[model samples]
Target: MQNNISHKQSNQAPLYLTNFISFPYQSSQQDIPVTQFMALSPFSVKWSSNGTGYKLYANSNPNPIYTGTGTSFDIPQGFKHNTTLMLEASNAAGKLYAFLTIIISKPTLTPDSITVAGTMDNPSILTVQGTLYAKSTLTINGTLNLGNNNSFNDITVGATSNIRGKATLAQLTANAIAGGASITTDANCALTLQPNATVNKLDTTSVTASGSSNIADLTVNGNITANKASITMMGSWNLIKQGSAFGEMTITAGTDGLVLVYIDPDNCDAGTNATAVITYNGQQYSVNGVNLYQVQSNNALKQGYCCVPVQKGTSWQCSGSTSGNGQSPTIYVYWIPFGADKSS
Candidate 1:
């Protein structure tokens, strides 16, 4: 008896085989981590193939390091560096080839530049040999030790924040405070508070206020000295109680027989003239002229009080005079001192 024999043969080569990689595939772009990639003694690998047999070659090896009739294979690991691998497969139809680079160690780097696009939580300390710049706000919740000088355009400190370290700056600028704030410095510390600033206890070298300054109370522990310190006042005093017009009104001499007006020597402005005028009845009278009789009893000294005696209901009044019949008229006063250094 004769039997008919038949055999099947492949006429087309393998096509579209991809993702030829080992398990836990380590990408070329990322550092090959230690426990997952480098520690495997024999890293397992698998590939897609429509071929009969395959052979894997390592770094310039003339002989195949691994051979398999199936699609999966193993790479005898124990590699200490980046390794190059080549995969060759062949079948009755044709042959196919692929290449791979395995990473067995992390790359060494000086890391001159690194941009952290996402949050980086590193438990270890990072040393930056070059400058580290942040396009936005760089918040540091941990301690940062700066190896070199750094410059910042603006910095805001919270009300609870405090600067306690010693620093010597060539130039330092601080903004004004709108609300109440306090600044305290040591005895040797030198602090300067510029315009529009407020503090509770200021032991500073200098405090200048070109703008408005409101201090509830200021207590200076050191010596208080003034240079060209001055207080100026300009206005007139209204002496009369009732009047039919708006000119100088004078008060009739009272029965006290005492000088009705006296200027405190310390509060007087010496060099300038403080001319007196009397608005009496309905007309204006100058003290240097008609109202001079009020001080005639004391010879009308340029300073001090003058007495004038007259009966009530008389129209003898001094217009814009500080003294009245029995009342002291309201007047504005200012103090300004001029000279060398004066201490208090």
Candidate 2:
């Protein structure tokens, strides 16, 4: 008896693959058959009496990689790198096929000195055991630290940047453009500012401005020892020109009978014939062995005259005919003219 199977009576429409995704990611040895991986065709056949079979053909190959009688078949190895495989399933009623791209390269690391640039999402982390370098700007939103004795070259911290740890560098350029930005050193460490650098404010134990500097305010917490200069208060003295005497005159009785007057050289011209009257009990006396009363007091009141009738560190004492203990007289002070020319 001869049996006939018609396509109209067949249950198979097309090969219904369980997973159409590419097979195993890695390939076995080059051009070698790798039978570990398998593909599945999960469809039912109407003519199961004839028994179903499967075949996998890789990349234009006419021969079947594996022919068997099941819904699944082992993936063939010996496939070239990145080749595609066509899986065919057939029975007495009908036959269908599905295409799957195969991957054949084992995972490998980055080649030496090759740079790869890509974005990392989902909060990924990259850990480097060796040195990492960024030729351009390196902006870290979080903290950055350097272990002890580690040094960085030519680092520039921005205006908003805050350096907390102790950073020791061969050379550093820090520009604090923002307000309230400052460089603070550790309590134990000493902060050294090089020559010609100007700082608005400084709070340290000791600061040595080797070069000229203008500081708004400097608060030193320790002793300030000046090696070469002295700190002086700010002020001066002016020459007060009141009046002048003209000739050999006896000091009359007035307010401050003996007035300690400032003989201004600007007003009292040279060669003026004037002498100081030094009389004790109506007897003429001399000062420092120089007869001032005879020397003509005009020359006595010149500039650089040590004994120009001025008291040292004390107010001038006046003893006139009307002066007495506890009852002093008020003698008027007047500029008597002894020279031909007189000044106010």
Candidate 3:
């Protein structure tokens, strides 16, 4: 008897596992990526997967630091430097791997005060948004920007120190200010220069002096408007009056004090033909040497010169006679103020 036994084969679907693993991230964190961690700070990495087993490895180590089925793992301690970690999830089908890079950062220190024994070069930056107080010398080799609406109580610069750019100050006290592009003062403000101060050049639109001011050797390239002016010169001549005929003329002195007047008569006939008499301060003075020049150009025209002392604002009178041709003599006056020239 030929017995043919046929074994029955079981038909079942192959086991397949779906991978729903997510990129590792810090627990309860938002807005920042999970690539950096502060040293000595404990944090947790969260993930999810559909696999039945999950393993986490740090820095590609063969042995896993965590082997569990949980969805999160807490790092024992933060890394000191940059590090890489890997997560592996496995089932009957195959294993799925995920990687992450964690950058380690130094912890922030918020001490009440920091005293550096030597130089600090590692950080190279210190930001102070508020007031900064330095009890000792604060030397800055770089640019110092005092932001808007900020001020410094006092700043003392050394000989070699240089301060550049525009600076606004309420009050500045210095022994000397040198090598500046310009200096400006507000309206109605007074810029006081000491007795020993020397200004190489001053260029401005207007300079008002309510009190007295003395300048030695001032050279002005523009107009000077003043209520009063006192000028002094040595061996210099000033032409006070010109192209004026000697007759019954009145002259008002333009000075503040007593002035000595010299009358120079030109184009006058010879020999007492032209006479000038001046009355000032209730005193009468006559113009002596009435004719000093000889006859010239076929005419008996000559010159006479005389000096008189008169006070300021005194209307001095000049009475003179005409020449032979009934023409008044042309006169030139020179004023020498006694206040300006002390020796006069």
Candidate 4:
């Protein structure tokens, strides 16, 4: 009897185990918060008592926390945001005990959600797919799982988020990628990875400026910046500026002034124009219009991008107000082929 009781003691309250996450995400889509995590997925839980083995609440209702024989447990979904993570531990003599309540939460996700914190002794992994708009700070251990085509929309990480193994897109931007990560939505597709003044990761992708178009305010890292007077972008509509501080726009032309078209990576073109949305970037003299001879198209736009220059009259409204961006921008004088895709 004592031996059986001893065995139970070894399997107490919050079990300590490895962890994993599964969310409904993809490489070229938007990211939605996941909601369920099966108990089988391993989790490291500190025991309530100084020793091992205990009871865990599997359901939110009936609230029947179970007493297990081992230190391992299978937690359920819905119960994730409990916040009050409590556990019960026991000893060989059938002594039940409680321990410190730990906080278990991660960035909000879709199908599966779990918080993985990287500690000095126990650093964990954070797998982000598609376009990630981190409203908070994230930490990673050896590596952060960044799939190709994955974009981080305005999220900051620990000093430097790296993968001792093979990290994916530690530094990310853009949307409409080929594939790899499991993201589903294109929210904040114009994602930006804060330039860690100290740690600047290389961007594997390239943004080319051609035709009579040029780019301005698009900073540099180690990434390639293709420039020319002609923009070889994809469609009749092109170039989605930094929606917020969306970098800057340079209009290239053979002559002096012309109209410019700005696409919305967040929304598709609305019939003749794209829908307009406003972010936090300033908008006084920062109007989305053609600056009289911003730059010349035939010239190289390492600092600008342009299209087939047109007469000043072709000035069409893509989706902004002659006043404020009351709407989205259209590829007025240029073809709509340019946009920021999340490339790894």
Candidate 5:
């Protein structure tokens, strides 16, 4: 009798484990960052293994998060911490392992637009990169930083809210703004105030108003010094007489108490004893005592000038004798209305 020999086949460990078929085992570990504002949807990690069974462990724990023969493991939602996941695939021989790192990071929000129905309270600093729009009101207890080249529209700050730091805005409409050291505009830019806008107090070193400025009421408590002053008269340089004898020239006054008279006598002898009288409001005023007369020996002419008081809308005239003999005199009169004094 002959003895028979027995034969046995040995099992082999899993090989070539990979999530991607094209690139098998390209990397042993994978890092994934989870943000605060990120979606909490279920995710899966798929792999192709030659093993008959698979188990996924989290953070080196003894208990497995998932155990199945499927090629993919579904990660549950609401995982909000840093976790290290290990996928172990096994057969009759040995086991193969794959690692993944879930890194929990700080919240980063990059939204195109945001609408808050109620209130958003942040104790720390709040920085904004893009355009922010508040339909109702925006209240910030801490600092608010609006980065460069960013603009916002229609922001209403409450009384309790405090806004600090540099802010560049396209347009701002507020009922009142208080407690700022200074507010400045860019070059070639203008800060426009509304028609009904009222500045209770403005304490600045200097103020320049360009173009046409229509101020309803401006009161200056301090002294006003200017280079030049221009006064516009209602009627200027009216010729009462060109070459005429001494006679009364009637004039209708345009403004009260603002009148100027000019007299040019042909010869100095004509103005030696010259005397002019203004009859206004049933009263006679003399201009002979006025020391505004100039006598030129070269031209033998005398020029007299005076500013007299006259009632508005009243009939007035200047009548006087300029010469003892026959001579002609040139006379002119003008008046300035109220609120015609302007300075440039």
Candidate 6:
């Protein structure tokens, strides 16, 4: 875009444009933005030492893709989202030239923002650079330097969103978490696993606790007992889990009380609360207030008790003692039914 002339130039020597000006090349679909090229005609005539030079091409496929003579150049670092740049301005007897074309956006487009700031390195080793759908609420409180040492992707926490603080990765790809993040508090979350980091498609308000902890109530079936075993949530437990062809653990039943055994997912094997009514596969569930049930054949207090619609080869055995009083807290339904009876 140039159209300012002055007349007479018999062989170039008595002219003036010490530096006609132009330094524009900047864009961002939603990141890496800041293109400075707004000040031109600042008293011209320096045209890069006059020997003539100014080249910058993009996706133009000419062997010279992304070259710069130096008015300004920095819009080249993995650009992809609207790349269409072409600028050529010449001199040195080429007789004065100019041709501009720019299209690389994002200065301030407000619409549930995704234009994150730059300068990252502190436990941050990103990959899976695509597919992000956050209608709202997605923030991290700094520190992400995880340089070289990859294996991290599949971060889906949509449907009542949340992603707050401390993110370390080497493996955490469960790829399916959206039950309204339970009650969110991710309690000072921290990560440092690399054995392919193993499954984490979570939404039970993922809080890794550093001070005031609480990451309970959402394990009725999320599957991540990878056995490299490392579960820490600090006391107040309600670690709900369900998926039993067999194998489970929460031990130490003689110190104060904590013995819930049902070993079998083959041999590594893997609920609670009042009101009782049980039956799986044939469908019918309700467990309210004072309940405990293990099975081999015995569940005579049936009725659609409350809200137990969890099924899949059967799993729900909450251990005894609902704070004793008149005694009816003994529940043992360890599974073995079908043409059997225990003296009913």
Superposed by TM-score, candidate 3 places the C-alpha of residue 150 at a distance from the truth, in angstroms, of: 18
Predicted candidate 5 versus true structure: per-residue lDDT over 1-344, tens digit per residue? 11112222356533545551111122243333222222333455666677788887778689998899888655646244555677777777666676766554543456667667666666544566555665444554333444344334434443332435455543444434334334444544444443344444433323343323333334445755544654333443444443333688787755454566666665433434456676777877665312223456343554677776666577777776644444445555555544433210
Q: What TM-score does candidate 3 get on C-alpha atoms?
A: 0.29
Give the winner by TM-score: 5 or 6: 5
* Reference-based lDDT, each prediction: 0.45, 0.39, 0.52, 0.33, 0.51, 0.32
Per-residue lDDT, model 5, residue 220, is 48
Question: Model 3, 107-218: lDDT tens per residue?
Answer: 4444567788777554445667565665454555454545454333444443333436555443333434445345454544445543344334444344443334444324
Q: List model 6 lDDT by residue over 103-199, tens digit each.
A: 3342222243254465433353334343344233333343323333222332323222233433433223222333332322233543322232222
> What are the runs in model 6 whose C-alpha is more than 4 Å off?
1-9, 12-54, 57-79, 83-86, 89-91, 100-254, 257-344
lDDT of candidate 1 over 1-344, digit per residue (tens): 11112222467643434446654443343232222355334565566667678887878988988887887664554455566667776767556667677666543335567777888776656666776665655445455454445533323332332333433332234444433445444455454445666555444555555545545345566665656664322222323332211344434432212113223223322222232433334654343211122343432224433433333234454433343222222222211112121110
Model 2: lDDT equals 0.39
Tens-place lDDT digits, model 4, residues 20-127: 122322312213223333323323332223434556543243364556655534343323432333344454434443332223344233444445455323334433
Cα TM-score of candidate 1: 0.24
- Candidate 5: worst-modelled 10 consecutive residues by lDDT: 20-29
Considering lDDT, where higher is better, how would the candidates rank from best to worst? 3, 5, 1, 2, 4, 6
- TM-score of each predicted structure versus truth: 0.24, 0.26, 0.29, 0.17, 0.29, 0.20
- The clash numbers for all candidates, in the given order, read 12, 19, 0, 70, 0, 45
Candidate 4 lowest-lDDT run of ten: 1-10
